[model samples]
Target: MSDSNSILFFVLGCIATLALIALIFKHRFFRQQKYLPKRVITPFERKMFLRLKEAFPQYHVLAQVAFSALITSEDYKIRQRFNRKVTDFVLLNASLDVIAIIELDDPSHIGKEQEDAQRDAMLHEAGYRVYRFTQIPTLAQLRKTISG
Candidate 1:
């Protein structure tokens, strides 16, 4: 073979080898990386969750519930609005029917009243009751608020 042809093949061979090594390294890097487990609810939410469970032993108290699980619509736009939104807690009866949507308004909820009202309105329009609290209520208070 001519020197020029031999040199071209050598360069091409080096490029192919480097490309293969790069592909292997990229695959290994991604494979070695993994997602770690995370807490599903915050510390405050955790405390409230326990309280809800204690307060409403007759009903199911679900925390960090996606709105999608509770409601759906035929309109894509309507679905888009709530698909990404999650509720702090959802109370369900023995028949698994949604009784009410509970929202704990911590410091994070400050200045979001308008947005929260809109969300609550949407839930109300869908025939679901919504309860908002700045702090965890006592067991009697919870029963009174929910039952009334």
Candidate 2:
């Protein structure tokens, strides 16, 4: 091939390679991020959340909410320890103040009793009422607990 034609072919090849690189990057990196269908709480927890809302119609029900937002501590260790923790359900009165924290003691919590106790204690120290239920509570039982 002539020198000019050889140089022209080399330039075309470089352009094609760059276009291929750009296409590959677009395919690999430009995908839109999105949320998938993931359950925030278990089926049992869902039932309990609904029941609590029914029991206290005026209260706002929050399920699987972060503990760090609900309560804080002055101590760094305490803050770090519970920063990433989550509560099963939190009930907020009309004023949006936390009225109570309801934790479902499911099978997964069996071996983690110590952690649960510590969590309950932490909430208590924070001046919040924490209620534990092995199974979903009856409307009457829940009302009685809330009232008394």
The candidate that achieves the highest TM-score relative to the unseen native structure: 2
Measured with C-alpha atoms, the lDDT of residue 120 in candidate 2 is 88
Best by lDDT: 1
List candidate 1 stretches off by more than 4 Å. 1-34
Worst 10 residues of 1 by lDDT: 28-37
1-148 per-residue lDDT for model 2 (tens digits): 8999999999999999999999999989986767578878888998998899899998999998898988887889879989888998988988999999999998888889999999988789889999999999899999999757
Tens digits of per-residue lDDT for model 1, 29-145:
867647888898889888888888998899998888888888889999999989889999999999999998999999998999999998898888889999999998888998899
TM-score of each: 0.79, 0.81
lDDT of candidate model 1 versus the reference? 0.90
- As a whole number from 0 to 100, the lDDT of residue 71 in candidate 1 is 81
Reference-based lDDT, each prediction: 0.90, 0.90
Q: Model 2, 77: alpha-carbon shift in Å?
A: 2.4
